[model samples]
Target: MLQLAWGLCLTALLGWDSAVLAAKFRRPAAVFPLPLLCAAALLVYAGALPGFLRAGVWGGVGALGALAVWGALRLGRESVRQLTESSGLMLFLGGAALLWVVLFCLQPMFFQWDEFTAWGLAPKMVVQNGCLYPAQPGNLKASFTYPATSMVTVLFQPFARWSEWGCMAALDTLAMACLAAAAALPNKRRMAGIAVFAAGFVLPYFFADTPAGSYAAQYANAMADLPLFLLFGGSLCLYYALGGQGRAYWLTVLPLMLLTLTKDICFAYGLMAVFLIGLDLWWAGDAPARKRFLPAVAKALPLAVAVVAAFVSWGRYTAAVTPLQETAASVGSEGLSYGAVLLGGVRQLLGIGREEKFAVLMSLMFRAFFTRRVCLLGGGAAAVGCITLAAAAAGCGAETGAARRRVVTAYLGLAFCFAALYLFHLILYYYNFGESEALALKGYDRYLTPYYQAWMLVMLALLGQGAGSRRGAGALCAVSLAVLGIFAGRGVPAAGFWSDASSRYTLRQDVQTKAAALNPALQPDDRVLVISQGDDATRWYYYRYELTGTVADGFSGRYTEVGDTSQREKGDFMNLVSPDNEYLYAGDCTVCTPETLMAYMQETGCDYLLLDRSDGYLQQAFSPYFAGGLQDSMPATLYRFAGCDAAVPFTVAAQESGVAG
Candidate 1:
C-alpha cells in the first residue's frame, strides 16, 4: 500500500510540468502524462548523475516532492476535473496492472537469471557504494558494460534500502505508464481502444499459452524488457501523432533520452525513432517536395544530437571501465560472410508465412491490433486488410487528386517505416549470431512487441482518416471490445486480487527467507564461495546476491552461466577466479585433496564453501573439504576451511617444486 501511494505521489510530482508543457503545445491529453512521467524519471536520473552519488539523488527527490505538492494544491477546480476525466479508464487499467506487479513483488520471485545478476546487481552496487562502478571480478555474473538504464532501477530502491519491492515498483510504474500511453488513443472510440489494449496487454499474464509466451512470466521477473518495449511503444505513438497531427514532435526527445538511458538494444531503437520522426517531419505537407523540408530538418537536429550524444557518452564510459567484447570477438570464428548472413536473414523473414509455427506469431500480432481473431487466421489476412483498406479508401471519390495521393503516401510511409525498423533489427541480429545459428530466433517475438503495437496504431490512424464514416469506426470499436471482453473476463481478476500460486510463481519465498536468515552467521568480510554441479546455479546466485549485500563470487559447471561470451580469455580468467568441476585439483584421487583444495581457497580468499548437496558431481569432487551440516529449504551444505594456513604453505611449496601438476 505504501508503494502504491509513493508511486502516485512520484508520478504527480514528475508529470505536472511535462504535462502542462505538452498541453500548451496541443499534444494529446492521454499522452500528456506519459511524457511528464518520463520527464520525472529523467529528473531523478539527473539527480543521481553527480557521480551517481546518493546525496545528489536525495536533493533532487526533495525538490521534486515540494514541487509536486505545490502543483497539487494549486490545481483549479476545472483543471482538477479535466485531469480526472482525461485519465479515466486508462488510469484504472494501469492501476490494476500495477496491482499484479505488486503481488508478484511481494512474493519477490526474481526468476530471470539476468535480473538477479545483471539488472538487479547494478543498481544494488550503486546503492551500496553511492555511485555506479564497473563490474568487478567478485561480481561478474552479469554483463558489466550493458549501459545506463540499469542504474534507473536505483530510483525504485526506497530510501536506499536495497529492497526488491522498491525495484519492482519502479519497473512496474514504467510498465503501467506505457500501457496507459497505448490506451490513450484519440478519444473517438476511446472505450474500444481501452478495451483492446487492456485485454491484449493484461491477458497474457493469466494465459500460459500466449504466442509470445506467458505475459506473467515477464512482469513476475526482474527483466527490463517489458518496460523497454512499452517505452518504445510510447515513442512510436508520439511520432505517429507528430506526423498525423503536426504537434511539436520534438518533445519526442524526452522518450529518446530515456530509451538511451535504459537498455543497450534500445539505443538502436532510439536511433530508429529519430530517423522516422525526421522522415515524418520532412514529408508532413502538401507543399512541393523540398520547400518545407529545411524547417523540419532544423526542428529535428536537436533530437538527433541528443541521441548521438547519449550514445557517445555511454560508449566512452563502457570503454574506459567495462571489459566488453569487441565486435570481432562477438562475431565468433565460424566466419560466415556478412553477405551470406544478410541473405539468410532475408530468407528467414520471407519464410515466416510458409512456416506453420509462424502462424501463431502472425495470429498474436494481428490480435494485438484488431483484437478479434476472426480476421487473423494468418499473415495473409493482414496483407489483405491493408490492401482492402487502401483500395476502399482510394475508391471513396471524396477528395482532390493531391489529397488522395497524400493519404496514400501517409499510409505507405507508416508501413514502410515499421518494415525498415524491423528489417534492420533482423539484420543486426543475423550479424551477431551468423547464418545457420540465427535461425532459432530466440526471444525475437518478445523484442518485436513495440513494433506490433506501432503497426496497430498506424492502422487505426489510416482507418480513422480514410474509412470516411462513423459507422466504420463504430464497427471496428465494437469488434475490438467484444474480443477484449472475452479475454479479460477470464484473465484479469477483481481489483487488488492475484493468484500467488500460479505456475508462473515458481520460486519459494519460504526458501529464500530461510537462506537469507543464514547471512547473520557470517561476518561482512568473510567470503563464502558457492559451487553447484551440472550448470544450474541460478537459485544459488540469487541467494548469495540478495543475502550477502556485498560483491561475491562463485563457480559453476559452465562458463556460459557466468556471462562468458564465446571468448577463451574470459573463460580462462573465470577458471582462475573460481575453479569448476572440470579443473584437476586432485592428483590420482577422485576428490580434491585437502592441500590442493586449501590452496584454491587461499587463492580465492574464500573462508567458507557452500555446496549443493543435491548435485552429485559437486559432492564427489569436494567431499574432503566438507565440514558438515545442511541447511533446510536451501538444501545446501556449508563447509568451513578449518586451519586453512597449514595446507596453503604445503600446496605453495609443491607448486614451487612443479609438483602441483
Candidate 2:
C-alpha cells in the first residue's frame, strides 16, 4: 500500500511538473525550474518521495536550504576585497542559511496542533479514499469541514498514503521555492534588500516550513491558505521576474489562475498580480505582451482547473463550516480592531477584511471571508523602500527600455491593495466584530497583509541597484540585524503557544506531544477516532504520532467538516472503526455528542465512546436534553459516554429512586 501510494504521488507530481518542464525545454525558455532541480533532487535523496510528499515540512526546509546554499556556491569565488566589500551581505546569507538549518533540524520539535486539525487531517482523508474525496467525520473530517478544494487538496497528497498535513507542506514549498527563485532573479536593486531585510520571504518560508508562536505555521500549514499565499506572492514575483516576455511569462500566469482557485483571498491579490502582469506586458511593448497571450493562456490552462476546484471547495466549506450557523455577525465578530478599521480599504484590496471593515461596505458586501496572517514590511520603512526603488528604476528608465511608469503603476496598485486590505479589517470591528468602542484586536499590520513584503522587496531591489549602503537602505544592517537579533534571541523561550481559558490546559502542551499521548498500541486492522477541539489531534498517524514502530495497517479517521451541510454521511459514520478495531482517542467539542451525535453513534454500533473535551466543556450551557443529563468532572479527565452524559446523570437521579446503572 505504501509503495503504491508513492507510485501515485510520484506520477501525479512528476506528470504535472515534467510536462511543464518538457514544454519549456522544447524551446529556449525563461526562468526554467532548473534552479529548483537541486531542491527537488535533495528531497528525492532524503527518503521515499511519498514520505516527504505526505509530511514534508522539515523536508522542504532542508531542500530549500540546501538548494540555496548550492546556488550561492555557484556564484564563483569572490576576491577577498569583493567579499570584504559585501561582508554584510555574506554574513546575512550565512545567518539566513544557519537559520534554515536550525529550522530543519528542530522542525520536528516545533510542529503544532492546528497542523493536525487542518493539515494532517485532510491528507488522511485523501489517502483513505486513495484520491481526493469527501472527508467524513470520525475518519478524517466532518462532511462539511473540508472546503471544495479537498478534492485536489487531497489529490495533491500521495494517493493511498494515509497521512495528514504532510502534502500541504510539500505543495506550499513548491510555490515558495518558485517565488523565492523569482525574487532572487529579478533585476531590481533591492534583490539584496529583501534578502537582508529578511521579511520578504516570511509567509512563503513559514507556510512551507514552520514558525514560532501560537499562530506561527498555524497560518502557513493550512491546506488551502498557504497555497493561496504562494499563488498570490509567486504571481507578483513572476511578473517582475518574467520581464514581460518569454517562457517565464507563461509560467507567471499559471500561478495567477491558481491564486484565484486557492481561496477568496486570492481574488484580491490575483487581481493585483494579473493587473501587474498586464502592466508589465503593456510596458514591455504595444504588441509584444499581447503576442505572448496564447503561450501564457496555454501554460495557464492546467492551473485553470484550480479555479474549478476552488469553486467546488468553496461551495463545500460554505455549505458546511459557515453556513447559516456562521452569520455575518459571528465572522465579523471574530476580531474587531481600529487597525482593522482604518486599514479597512487596505484589507479589502488585499482580500483580508470583511464588508463591515471595508471603507465602502458595498464593495465587498456580497462576499464574506475570514483573513489569515499576512506578513509584509512595515511603516516609514515601507514608504522609503518604494521611493528608493522608484528612484532606481527611474535612473535606469533612460538607459534601459523598461517602462518606469508601468512599474510605478504596478507598485502603486500593490500599495493600494495592501492599504485597502488593512483598512477593511479596521472597519470590520464596527460592522463586523461589533466593536462600538475603539477596536483593538490588532488588525492592520503587515503580518495580516501581503503588501508589506511586496513593498519591502520592491524598495530593497531599488536600493540595491541605486546604492547598496545599509543606511541608504534605511536603518543600517546593524540596527536591522539587532531587531531580528532581538527576535531571534528570544527564540524557543518565547515560542510558547496559548489558547483560550476553556481549552488552555489541554491545548497548551506541545501539539505533537498531545497527539503522541493519545496514540495506542494496535493491530494492522485497528482503527481510531479523535474528537478534538481547536486542532488537537492531527499528526496521530499510528506511525508518526504513536512512534511505537509497531506494525499496524489500520486506516485512521477524524470528525468535523469544512462548510455547511458538511458532516459525516451514514456510510462513513458506520465505518468509524473497522469491525476489528481496538482503540479510539477522542478530543472535545460540545457540538459532538449532542442529541444528534447519540443517534449517529448508536446507529453505528460504537462499543465505546471517549470524550476528552479540552479544558472543560463540563459546565457548558447545554440543551435541556443534555444539561439535564451529562455533566463535567475532573480537569482533563476522560469521560465515558454511552447513551448520553445526560442519560447517565438522569439514570443516577432515577437510581436514587431505584434506577439501574
TM-score per candidate: 0.71, 0.51
List, residue by residue over 132-212, the lDDT tens digit for candidate 2.
222223333332233223333333343454433334334433443433433332223333434433544443332121244
Local distance difference test, per candidate?
A: 0.50, 0.38
Candidate 2: residue 552 Cα off by (Å): 27
Clash totals in order? 2, 81
lDDT of 1 by residue, 294-392 (tens): 876776787778877776665565555555553222332555655665565566668842444334444444354344221222232443363345334
Best by TM-score: 1
Strongest candidate by lDDT: 1
The alpha-carbon deviation from the true structure for residue 645 of candidate 1, after best TM-score superposition, in angstroms, is 5.5
lDDT for 551 in candidate 2 is 16
